[model samples]
Target chain A: MTNIKDIAKMAGVSVTTVSRVINNQPYVSAEKKEAVKRAIEECNYRQNINAVHLNKGKTFLIGVAIPFSNHPYFGLLVEGIANAAVNNNYKLVLFQTNYEESREIEALMMLKHKQIDALIICSRICGWDIIDEYVSYGPIVLCEDARGRRVSSTFIDHYKSFSIALEYLHNKGHHKIGYCIGRKTGTNSKQRELAYRDFCMKLNQPLKPNYIFYDCFNFEDGERVVKRLISMSNPPSALLISSDQVAAGISTCCKEHNILIPNKLALMGFDNQPIAKIMNITTLEIPLVEVGRNLFLQAIENNDSSHQEISVKLIERLTV
Target chain B: MTNIKDIAKMAGVSVTTVSRVINNQPYVSAEKKEAVKRAIEECNYRQNINAVHLNKGKTFLIGVAIPFSNHPYFGLLVEGIANAAVNNNYKLVLFQTNYEESREIEALMMLKHKQIDALIICSRICGWDIIDEYVSYGPIVLCEDARGRRVSSTFIDHYKSFSIALEYLHNKGHHKIGYCIGRKTGTNSKQRELAYRDFCMKLNQPLKPNYIFYDCFNFEDGERVVKRLISMSNPPSALLISSDQVAAGISTCCKEHNILIPNKLALMGFDNQPIAKIMNITTLEIPLVEVGRNLFLQAIENNDSSHQEISVKLIERLTV
Candidate 1:
């Protein structure tokens, strides 16, 4: 088989010119391109390194394993990831696992097979011990703040975020507060719950079991949680919600019942999403997009294992 | 260099077994797999066909070009496409273009370079003429209904959808209807405009310039649009919103002004997004996920050139 140099020689062009033509670069003249094509045919040349493949040792592809995309948290995170990816001339491969363990493993397998240069687990289902094994193949970054020295991660300190929200509510003279949670055992949810419990304990406020709502992420969950609160003989004066969407849901139900927010049932939500701004709902603003961008950047740039903690702020508005 | 056959012969295993070991298939015995790796190392073999790469002539990767993933429409479409891609053992490369033409062309370039097997343009920035050139490289599918036979497309007929929406509004005794639009020059927005104009003309109702709200897509846009309508001396009795997101925005603004939905101002929205369902806003349900699934299936399964049109339905709820 003839090599590219032999073809270049036969075509009366430089090796770089032949290489440019093969890579589909635009500078070569049509006449020179024709000559190169003819030489390639005459010599029966086959370049094993095709333009189809990305540059050697750099696939320039990133895999993101998120439980779902339509949700507010993941969507905001992806928005940041996608922008950073396009700027860096990379593409995002999303694995919508619906929080299933097997679905999450598919992205890990892709990393093992070198299908993607790195993996970003947005909402991890499995522990770091299992994920640390794939670090040898490529960078494996977790979105949650994990205590893994061998792995890289970017996360909002959910504990501090919850504390900010809880402190804000307590400052407003709301001694009794109920909070909504997404998952019963999710790392972020657990952190938020711990913060709530600790805050109540320090204040000498009763931490009632009925005040804690679990598995609350969406609008309906928030609505149902609020309705359950409303039916209680002694409902908490204020509510710390998990997400803006759920808060919005609570607001909707309140409207139907003629229950004025803050006065009747004060509410503070998480993830200061656009709707939070629109609805004027006070929330602990977790910069999810920034977390995603930083996670991807760290995976690509920081080969040395490191962890990044994104800070959160409390934005005051009408609902709270 | 030694090949798989030589390694197989040295290990006393069939070439199939050697290939299976290289590909990381599960059924191979641990002893046999170890022997093949040893034989491969001894011969100093370098196969062009590596496990890192997909099978020869097939990357099993599809590129999807969308303006943004954070939006409800694109998010739903991606969910469908991602599900299909995972089921087919393929991966999705998202090109979040933010509707930029240059960004869209990047996905096309990936197709040209054989990085992805096909390209799915969810919302096109460029026309078919430019995209037709890349059809020879691989399949290019459009998310919107296009007048291109060479390329396969799966889309909700915007014209038909608007017609259905308009007729329903008209039947409900809405003579003067205001409509919101995302882009003044977008294909879907334009199609919707034409439908509104045609419907009014056929019904002997005049199409008012003030009734058409341009550059509205998100919740904030809808709020601003409705505020503009309220200040007008002659506001339309009903509004046909471009998206459920915009409708949700409109709903938020309405609540702020103490305005009643359906009773004071009748409204219609497009894309029955989760928010829309939660808000109980009347909307035309565009099967965005189904469109995504059919688009991927068509690109992968269809060899012969054809077009598919996904239908939309109006889901009657509160605030129609």
Candidate 2:
């Protein structure tokens, strides 16, 4: 806890002399340097890392802004980021934003304040303008497409992936298809919505707003979806769930409700999470961990703004 | 990035004078302060947070060392910690130690280096002596029993909880009970093992080493357990799965293999996670988030070393 002043006082030297000695500057005399070293040893003063970071202009800390730390989606992403960070000797400063814009801004502000070397936003809640404003401060890596933007990102083509899922369902003779998503506002969700709209247009099918389930993030949400499905006058024959957790939930609920999957209610899930495999639910595999690793790598390694797109694949399982 | 020396040079003043001005010390003249302000504005030099942290001797950053970030158990614990951290205006520096001693030491080293204000070991891999060595650096809160130790902790009475589970199973006519665990080395796991041993002794049941499952951390591990169970000459009638995720997996696999629950094998899971509810798997509710919140509170709020033991409750459902 000894400050520079304390070290200087203990060593019988000026504060500036102590600073010079600590920094190993040439101006500090040998006798004064030795005195400062002795004082430091006697006081057991461990040099604060913040001061070292201030001098070096690098904290080796990458800020990761996530919505929720406990969710499976973010958990996988963080695992990828954390592993890459450890490999590079960089620690992660987690900002669990809980989808709050203010919390996301706090992460950006940390970048501007030089508390962290860079930031990788796992799930962004802020507007482009707000994010764009802080680009000059430090590297801001995103998990969504940031192409034609100042910042860098490692993103998935949500539109393409959604289309793939839709086309697969369509080929399986499922014309009345509905989908579930975490939220409608996110860029990925918007892209998926667009894909759904396009699919509807191509098939000349009416887009039933009621059929699209929102805020379906966890396993519990699946019960809500199934309850709604059972009550609907004309429920979709097949459903595309954005998260595998939700899909697994629906699968479990279907068994309880005697709703045979792929016959009465076909279920296709995204992310291909472990639950999907356990429940034998068909899903689109989004390499979230790989995307996370790329995001972290871009945050620390990239000097110029860059965008990397990761692809998703469909894993055929029992449900579909 | 314009440093203090650059700002001083721009203001036509010495580095010490600029430092005094930046620190708002009374020694700097008003004219010099005005000059420094103008230089700061012209150069657009943002005040580095590291410098402020250096002066205040506080980072407002707590280190959270967990084995993995993607696992449900740790995920839920981190969620609790993160929420508490946000409430306290603190950020978490995640150290995904992956159960490696070297990785854990890195987190301890960060505490020693004053990079983080405090550290919370969610699942400790390092020995007590190593952790004890860094106690003087800052508060190191643990998620296991650390009573009679220097550090603070919010722990569960694993032995009592495990006994309660065993008693519940025994009363339900499940004398031949086996348990699946993440590992046998952790303190909590050791306590659970002791309880299991004691239960066998009380029942005059022969100890079956092969009945105990180790490294059963995830859902996929359940398949491994089931495969072994099917091949066994006399598989246990009931299984105590430490994680609900693994329990859920066993439930799913059991159904696939035509093994009836309760009649064939009763499953008792720990940590009543969402998966447990979906699968109707009976489990011991650990209240992990509450434990996590208490852990975080202990890390920041407690001045003296403290120990808080959280209790678990049995939530009965179908799988039991």
Candidate 3:
């Protein structure tokens, strides 16, 4: 309800004089300063922090565009971002798009409107076209995939990791392997699918349509996919899962059916999440916390700059 | 940066006349309106939205005080709150206190300064003195414990759930049972701990000092606790864990050590999260999503009212 102009007008001075006094930018006469103070006291004026922060065009608020914060995968990633943000004297503002196209656009709009300094998209399944449209607004980094764009991204090498798991199973004389992959639209999932297809084609193996199950990158989907495999007349001897949570679900299903792991069936998982470590589910461990930290740092530095891509690693365990 | 006073002063008119022009509140002459408009344009001013928001003492920003957002326990809670806040046209401003006393005070300061409309404390490990001090600033709602305060709260009956768990174990002939709880400083954990003490005392069972472990609430802590239990000459027949993640860790450790569940050593967990369902973890389920939603709705209403508290339930499963 109060502003610099109000104080200035009341003090019989220009708005610039009030601005200088408020910002402590100097070059103000003592008499004018006293008059401005009197006017400010009388009007009960308060400075708008958001407006001032906007003028600098840097809010020190990093927006983390996560699909869902409740899931284990993103949960770790968010912790990484938040931990990094606080250390850097920045705060995190979560923008859960739920993979909705409109919400992604809204995240971009926030940058254009100077609401947030940068954005980190973790496990987004949206198309590249939608992202490309808003790439110019601010810094946009991908957590799971490189996207092949100039954008700075932090991701594990999904193709290589998938190949490594396949090779491990292949070396164990398992020609028939069922695969459970998360939503196929994203670059990461696509890479995994491609790896699976390419490996089978190269080895002259027949790919079973029923063996592959599309999942939502969660434990329930892992259970659902495992059930599909169990119900089939001929299930694959080995399975490669999208995540550790999925592997847990599959392991639970196996226990229910009395199918002992590595004895009756072999399994491998990805993301090497903490659960993976606990369950001893064979998986390719990616530096999730590091990815998150690097993502935030990238966002801060490249707030108004271009994009870049980061890579991932593989960790082996006993499941296979 | 302009206010009603500025326009009135420049137009040589009363503040009431400027307010009438700006808000179209009626009874403003054509000359006065023209003068006000000209003065406003010359000043290049914008209304202080924060000040206007504060004028009504409503920021439309709800504060969610949570311990950790990176874990499934609080992550799900935050998700439910965010979803409800979005649907209701309100923004949930995360105030992650991490159970720290200083950050808790920061949240109270925000409420006192009218930066947040109300506060929804997910769990109170902070104690009653701090809570009482902030209660008068805005409406406060507790998530999992009443704290015996007059605040509105929504949570499950920890005592009932613990009793159910212990009774199930008792019925299963488990004379030697170990209880693993979170940090005892929190109200929720305190309830769980009290339940353990009372039930053990009523059953005429002496509590083993080494059988109880206090964790900081994470997967690593769960794993560490299990390691300690496994090292004992006469370990407990069953273990009750504070969270599903912790249970997963203990289960993983058991698998590695060739220990069996509900067979060689029974295990039960709390919070029946997504992983718990997949793992068939026998425990009492706390409806965290419902807690989050109800607490947020209470916060919205709290914007104009006082404190209130709610109730909780126990969803039983097969862990015992």
Candidate 4:
């Protein structure tokens, strides 16, 4: 119940003097400091840890701004982050923005208020203008896309990964390759879409606009995409998907329809999630734990001057 | 940027009087209230909405204390709570304690500080004495068990559910039945263990000590349990597991070993999550969304009463 005001009154000094003494800052005489310390000890005053930490410009909390926490990709990312956080003696306070502008802004405001030491955005939903504005407040790190932004970043290259999946299918004598991606709004999806477009243009392959399906990046979304693709006028022999969950959906649907994988319809996916292994869907295994570890390191260092973008590698499986 | 103190100083009034005017509380002079309001308007002071909401003794933030958020069962529970919270115009703040006593105490302290309006404990890790101390601060609703000393709870009857699963297997002519439970420290697991004991005693069947396996309610844990059971001299023909995630692990392990379900080993699990449906694991469907709704209703009512318990029902599947 004891506050700085109580310590100041007992020490016969102003609240500022008491604050200086507690923070170990300069300008307080030894006598006054001793009196303040004695008064604090007498009252057993417990200084607010978060408040004091803020005043000293060192909030121990790290803010993670993400869209959702339930999906296997994001879930694994969070698990990696959480594991590293526990090891590094740090705590995470999540901000589930659900891709809303207002909620994303709230996470940025925490930096200005000195509530969070730094921020790690897994996937940005807002435009770069807003992201640029918040970058001045504190250290801001991006997880997925760099977007050629000035802020520090750590992510896998979606363009190259998507190209590799498609190129592999094309080389296997499967020229008619379709694709499924996450929401078109995200930077990662945009990159993947660009990769898909450029690859089709170069190969002189017919680019069917309806071949691309964009929605949530989950198993159910993948399943829906597969349904749409299967019912298409000219369904491709091979499919390139954004995430493993989506691949699972397509695989499950294929099993139900008796469309055998690799033989009937080949598939390649991204994010070699556990289910991808169980279902034997060839995928690009982006090091999720490493991504989380690097993000935490960047956040704790509190430096945005240097940015790092990790590369993605393909994990071969039976689906292809 | 402006706070109550700034308005009070400009209006030549105490901060309490300014708060009284802002909150529209009685016992403030008309002239002073008018002056405070005028100063607030002149300074363009916008109250911190979150702080003002806190001042009204209703933050609309429900703290959900769970062991893990990545698991399917807990994830579904979170989804249920989040859906209910959206309906009620509330937000959920997840506090992943990993069943640590210190973390539970921190959640209780958040309630004391009026940070979170109420608490929905999906898993109990706090002692009864500590829970008793927290009940005075705000509503604390239990979701996993009903054996609270004074707290109101919405929980499935683990004992009855376990007994039914065992009895169903017994009726199918399986005398040697195995059991896989969660950590024994939890009330739900304790009840299930007691039920197992009672069923064995009543049937006058020899209880195979090696048939029981205990682990965390996770996929890997279930697989590990099955591995140990199959290695035993005589493994039970039917196994009763505590969670769907664990059953998935066991199912995966069985598939790897080419062991047929229902024919080689009958498996019955708890918490009929979506994954259970996909894997065809027979389980008791604990109505999670209903539990969330009931707990939210209990929290809003703020009734101080003894614990409440909910019932569970078995859902037959191909695994049985």
Candidate 5:
């Protein structure tokens, strides 16, 4: 093996000069650079690319911080990001936080250490203040509608999408309409809550506390919600679910219980996932793939700090 | 501000000596090692950990190469790998190849370049010759049953499991049995086809070429298979689906076409994924999470080029 020592000795320069030349550091004379290059060529040394990348202050690697990897929504986003990374000649290092603070911090630390050129945060438990601290390190692109936080972001207007779902349900002669949520405190959920409340107030429909199901993320959660809803003294006529997966669950459980959809209980889901089309569940189509592509673009540009909004549209299916 | 150059100058030693000291390389004289240490301490130098890792020939990073990121089987496997990585203080660098040879080469290159300590190839398109060439670079762990190639592997006994599935379907009085495949030439699929053929030949049952569906990896593909199957002059009374998601699609499509599961068509799916449970499809449990953990364990061990076969169990559900 031709070590750095060999290169230095062969170049007939101080080890410091050889080190500087090898690392692509400035202040090395043209003569020393030529000598180092000649030595490397003569020795045919296979240098670790990480050494070059560390010196360049960029790795062409993007860090994607997401709470989950297997979830269809996040999976679609990751797939889109993967395509962009391939096209742009970058690699994505995933930080599957699972909503844990410690795991999320690992990604931010990688940014601080210059392990990655940029970061794309899909969702976060940490506050904006915590995220802002790493802004100077490199581009920090958010995959959320955080236009108010002053960073590059690509997201769908959850409030508007939720409003579309609620208003559609309300106009369908459903006075008592309830909804499902993943988390009460998440920005998307908060906006959805606001939209639900505003729609109820505008339509003069009384809001039922029990109708709001919390933490409904998957199909099983939707089934559990439906089981709970049926036992209630008075259940809503229609339900606006947080995600299509949840709606799929409710649909399956409903079939088992012989609860005819739309005829007995109207259901509307969000995200318009492929399953939604298969299940014929009317949904708000959140362009997550577009959000992912835009996030990568912003991170690569590392500038503009402009908020990018991906449009959401309502798809009509038999469930509503 | 204190780079390797300053450390070399301060230590009164070659930059290579300072690098060897920082990288914890052996064979340095006591005097030089002590001098480099004292100089580093005096300067309060904070070396780039990446530089140190590069020199040490270790990065504590494992490259995970999978065809899809969001698919349930791969997602579960990745989640398992992520947990193992976190526990072992290693990071997973994902290469979502999507069945592309070019993308898969990137991970192998990273392994050769010492960017990653090892590679955990979940699935790959590259031939064994290409994969075997990189054996000296680092430990290569496969998610498939490729024991014949002389590498560490964590995989299911697909042949045995498929035989079990076929025999079980036979005992259930299904003579006209068909199956779907992701790729015609995949090891798992080949085993499954062998089982299907061996079972048919032994039982003196006729094999219908039209029943063998190709490229049935996803939900849409499965739905396409079902649509094509029902239109055939003679369709199989039962189907052994390639994956649970595909089975879910068939189940959903069956519901639309006013077909009764188990009675009209017996469906058996693989992977026993969460969607399988929701759809109530009978499946062979591959224990993907267990496979992932075992792969990581073998990768970290970096020895014992033994073939590991994870057992598969048949789970009875309403669909079958």
Candidate 6:
């Protein structure tokens, strides 16, 4: 509750002298500094950290923008980022954007205003132009490929990962393949869409718009996919799910419906989450924690621009 | 990068005049105010938010300390807190304590230094003595029963909830009952321990210390429990698991090992998470999000210390 002014009044010195003493600036007399120190100790005064940050031009706070905080994927990412932050002597300001552009803009504005030293966006809802406008303000790190952009990123080659999964399904004698994703927008999803189109064209099969499922993020969304699948006259024999939570959900629903996995409907999941191993669902493992760590490191690094690519591996399990 | 001094120089005014004009304080001449405004616009200066907070003696940031960011229990609680914070125009400074006392001390220190306006500890590692030391710094809200303490809290009556579950199992004709917990130290866990001890005494059963499980948090921990159960000469017929993730793990392991549920072993889980519902495990529904919302509200409320007790419900399903 004690401010510098209180300390100044108590020490019988000007407020500027108290400020100089607190900041260790070389203007205050030794006697005046000792008096200010005694006054501070007597009152148990704790210097406001904001004032310290104002003098240093660094807040020691990083802004992390994620759509949802409770999702398994983002949870892992945040855990890694938080761990790295702790080691670097920084704290995180979480911006749960919920995939809203306005909320994402709020995070960007915080960077522009110098509230946070840097920002790491796990997934962005804003377009490239909007994100580019804030690049000169501070470091903006992305979890997607921004190799040619002004910002830095730690990304996964979603196109290659999707192609590998589709090819594996194709080799397993499954030409009728479909996929589910969190949303149809975003760079990652668009890359996966391109891979699926190329796979269909290479196999001389017409693309089925109905085969792609959108808005699948959690286990509950799996129920919606199942309902749509059963109602279709020609459902894909195998499906690639973007999240293990969703894949696990579909697997559970299949069991309840007496639909045998890998025989009735093959499933391949992404993220290789713990549920995937427990449910025995084959998945492409993306090391989200490692990606999150790299994102944080890049955010703090004073480099021009950097890009790091993380590779995914396929884990063989019973569901495929 | 243009500071107040630069603006003052450009406006041909003193720094105090520039500060007064920027803060909208009265007594500045109309011509001088217009000159300061034009200078500010010309430079496109952004007022540092930290300076604004320093002047107001308030930061629109609340601190949240959780043991882990990736756990389901804390995840749900954080989601609730985050939603409430977004609605109230506040951001969260996350301190992933990982149950370390030093980490918790850092969070308390932030409060003392006036970095965060208030702190909401979802779970605590420090003792009451240490927490009491920071009570006068700001509003410190807990997620445990802190009725007689100086801080406000929104907590569950762990003793009553544990008793209800034990009574339900007793009525179902179970004698040998064991329980699992994340740890044995916290107030909540101690209450559960008391309830278990009293249950055994009331039923004329011997207290089996070996029956109590410790360090069980995630789904993978179920494998360890099952391994220990199979190795025991006389294992418990029914078990009370504190987390649904662990319960689901035990169920999955049980199916693999050909153990029948409710026949060989009956299980009751807490926190009725999504995994509990998906796996059809009987659980106690603790509205964690609602509890989190209340905790946030209490953290922001400038009232005397208040305590809110959230009740739990029994959700009957197949696993029990």
DockQ of each: 0.29, 0.32, 0.16, 0.11, 0.23, 0.31
Docking quality band of candidate 5, CAPRI definitions: incorrect
- Candidate 4's TM-score on the B chain: 0.81
lDDT of 6 by residue, B284-310 (tens): 999999998999999999997999999
Tens digits of per-residue lDDT, candidate 4, B247-267, equal: 888888898888888888889
Stretches of model 2 off by over 4 angstroms after superposition: A1-52, B1-48
All candidates in order of DockQ, best leading: 2, 6, 1, 5, 3, 4
What's the distance in Å from true for residue B240, model 2? 1.8
Reference-based lDDT, each prediction:
0.80, 0.87, 0.72, 0.75, 0.81, 0.89
lDDT per residue, candidate 2, A1-320, as tens digits?
A: 34555677899997656655664657777888899999999997756665667677888899999998888888889999998997887889999988866578668878988889999998888788577778999999989887998899999999999999999999999989999999889898999999999999998988889989999998889899999998999999999999999998888888999998788989999997877877788999999889889999999875779999998989999998
- lDDT (Cα) of model 6: 0.89
Q: Which stretches of candidate 6 lie over 4 Å from their true place?
A: A1-48, B1-48
Q: What is the lDDT of residue B220 in candidate 5?
A: 75
Question: Which regions in candidate 4 have their CA more than 4 angstroms from the true location?
Answer: A1-47, A50-54, A57-59, A88-90, A147-150, B1-47, B50-54, B57-60, B85-92, B289-301, B305-308
TM-score of 2: 0.83
Candidate 3 vs candidate 4: the lDDT winner is 4
Superior candidate under TM-score, 2 versus 5: 2
lDDT of 1 by residue, B142-247 (tens): 8766655678888777888888888888789888788888888767777888888899899888778988898887887876887797799988888888899999
- Tens-digit lDDT track of model 4 for A99-195: 7554566577566556567888887876775676667778888887674676777777778888887888888899888787778767778888889
lDDT of 5 by residue, B48-115 (tens): 65665756667777889988766888988987887787677677788878786656766776788777
Tens-digit lDDT track of model 3 for B224-310: 876787789999999888788788677767777887777878878877787776666776667777777888887877344334343
Interface root-mean-square deviation for each candidate? 9.3, 11.5, 12.9, 10.9, 12.0, 10.7
- lDDT value for model 5: 0.81
Q: Of the candidates shown, which would achieve the greatest lDDT relative to the real structure?
A: 6
Q: Name the docking class for model 6.
A: acceptable
Model 6, A1-320: lDDT tens digits are 45555688899997656656765768678999999999999997767766667677888899999998789999999988998987787889999888966567768878988889999999988888578768899999999988899999999999999999999998998979999999899999999999999999998899999999999999989989999999999999999999999999999988888888999999999999988988789999999889888999999999978999999999999987
